[model samples]
Target: MKQLQAELHMAMLMITHDLGIVANMADEVVVMYHGRVMEAGSLDDIFRDPRHPYLRALMRAVPRFNMAPGERLTPIREARASTEHLISGAARPHVAHAHDGPLLTVRGLTKRFTTRRTSWFGAKPGGEVLAVDDVSLEVRRGECLGLVGESGCGKTTTAKMIMRAMRPDAGEIVFNEQGVPRDVLALEGDDLFAYRRKVQFVFQDPFSSLNPRMTAYDIISEPLVIHRIGDADERFARVKELMGLVGLDIRFLRRYPHSFSGGQRQRIGIARALALSPELLLCDEPVSALDVSVQAQVLNLLLDLQDALSLTYILISHNLAVVNYLADRIAVMCAGRIVEVASYDELFRNPVHPYTRALFAAVPDPDLDRKLDFAALMEGKASNPAAWPQPFCLDGSVKLPLLDVGDGHLVRASADADVSELRA
Candidate 1:
């Protein structure tokens, strides 16, 4: 902050998991889970008047420092079937003012991969792994929608599909191009290539994303050369400008990726993402790979870039706190499906999804008096991941219904009434 104040400049992208930093620096926040936005709003609205179930659970999960010594704090709930109603809202026109029109839209999207196995004859695959199953979402211009979930929940795969790095099995990806709705999945040849220029990605691992053999200037300029957007002189000039835009020293342009720290490399990644002046940027765990302190800087950079360039973003990560700070809306995902979606404040105050609550509970809160032993909690429950047929429904017989209780809040139902309710 001191350096930025002294330079009178800021970053282009910032990704992180900390809330304190966000409270101090962020103008908006979007909470996500499993490649979906669950809640979103301005910073004050989210923290002070959270309206979503997932957001509420997350806030409760924040460890505090002033709890009476040994009193047991409330535990977060787990995802289940009975909470299905929580996923439904009162079906109103999507007239959210914070953001307008879908910048990126996914309808009836599904991605299934056939497993490759050895056979007597050169045989085709038998079964498939359904990574993403019938997911639909809309992100408007200049809006930040966060996707949050646990590990191995297909969050990264969803991002890849949006970036066209992975193909979807079935669905429509609609985006506005020159004032017309275009099917992103069908784009090819020059159209596809051009779309790539308009929609860019900031990878999770900044160090790996940046080429070791290339100088920072080369890295930033490479996009211009490939897109054939500007002449050599213009590209060089743009490269220096990008360096400055991302809060990096122009002198560092000649330096290699390995020459800089993790946070600096991420800045380079941001500069490269901006080379095309993209309308949308897909962030895949952008801050997970950086140090805690460094994460804040990168996150701030992203926010600054969004404001300066009018960039819309789809932020993917498993960190609820981070999502709460960056997203305008959030979607909670579990087992390849979105269990709930709501504005940031709504979701934080009253999350309906059991899975969402469990996720929040998993977060260690110092303020609360709670035990931290998962094995003990699951003594009667199955301990092995594979042993459990499903992450949400541990027992095969359990079925959940999505219900909208009120104010756009949805919850999954469980057989046991206790299961349907969040653990206190």
Candidate 2:
């Protein structure tokens, strides 16, 4: 971090599967799995007061601090009942916290794609796969809302909708500012262009997101040029300033994307996003592909930028620890739906969803004293959406009708069945 020569007192925004790193780095935490949030809290709260069933499983999965050499760590279990409509309630009292208000809301958003026919198969048509299904969510001003899920759970799809990179078939995207809600998806022409300026996207791959041919200066200044925000001199000045804001040296501006390292590339991507001075930033797995050290640097930069700019961000990722540290609130997403939503501290203390529990159980423990790997115990447990067993939830049993169990904690309605039943 010192070698990068970043700015002052950098605040971290970490994302990782490793819990030990989380314990050491995160000020707060959010636990998630299978696109659903299982828990979140301060590092101590998650370690000390794990009220959610899933959380307990995660704790046990951590190799025992004192155990026989050959003994295996126990994997977390799921409920026997179907997850179609189960609702798990909070075990602790609810507490309300301050939020900056909804800056963006996605309502009834849905998208689908039909696979193109193959010539060898006589142009056989492929069925439609629903990527996003009537999903609704809101990000408060100056707030980080974490969107979590397993791979292919539509986390990236949802982020793309926010970026207008992919159009939703059915939904209303409302951008609320100063108590006024404007339908973002319905706008066109200059209105749409203006809306694009208001919302910017930061992709997961820094290597591919940038134009290889363009220098960092051109890449960052492109948005300014397209939007006609500043003249040549001012745009150049802004580019240099943004590079510095993201902890990059001014000398980097003349270099192409390939000239930098993974971490440096991401910083340039961030600088471009800031060029438009967007109000809402849609971050799609921004740190997933980087090294542990690099991840920390990028995460820290994000936190510093948020504080400095008071920006609203919708952060999408599979890593729970990252969300736990940075997000004020969280929503766990499943196949095309938001299965649970809650404040960071409250949810971590008491997770209400079964999938959420399973996800938490999947996290690897680096500091565990035991030699057993809990992930192996969890194999054949995650749900497979296609060819699922009767009353199956792609992993195990889980009913629908995800219920809001009060205090803003939402979970699958079938929260009664215990671990034994979940495995049966």
Top lDDT hit = 2
- TM-score, cand. 2 vs. native: 0.71
lDDT (CA) per prediction = 0.68, 0.70
lDDT of 2: 0.70
lDDT digits (tens) for residues 218-291 of candidate 2: 99999998999878988887787777678788887799999998888988898899787778888889888775
Which stretch of 10 consecutive residues in model 2 shows the poorest summed lDDT?
A: 85-94
Highest-TM-score candidate: 2
Total clashes in model 2, counting residue pairs 3 or more apart in sequence or in different chains: 35
* Model 2 alpha-carbon miss at residue 290, Å: 0.7
Q: What residue runs in model 2 are displaced by over 4 Å at the alpha carbon?
A: 1-101, 119-121, 369-378, 385-399, 414-424
What local lDDT does model 2 show for residue 339?
A: 68
lDDT of 1 at 171: 82
lDDT by residue for model 1 over 140-222, one digit each (tens)? Answer: 87788888888767788888888899988888898876457888998999999989988999999997888899998889999
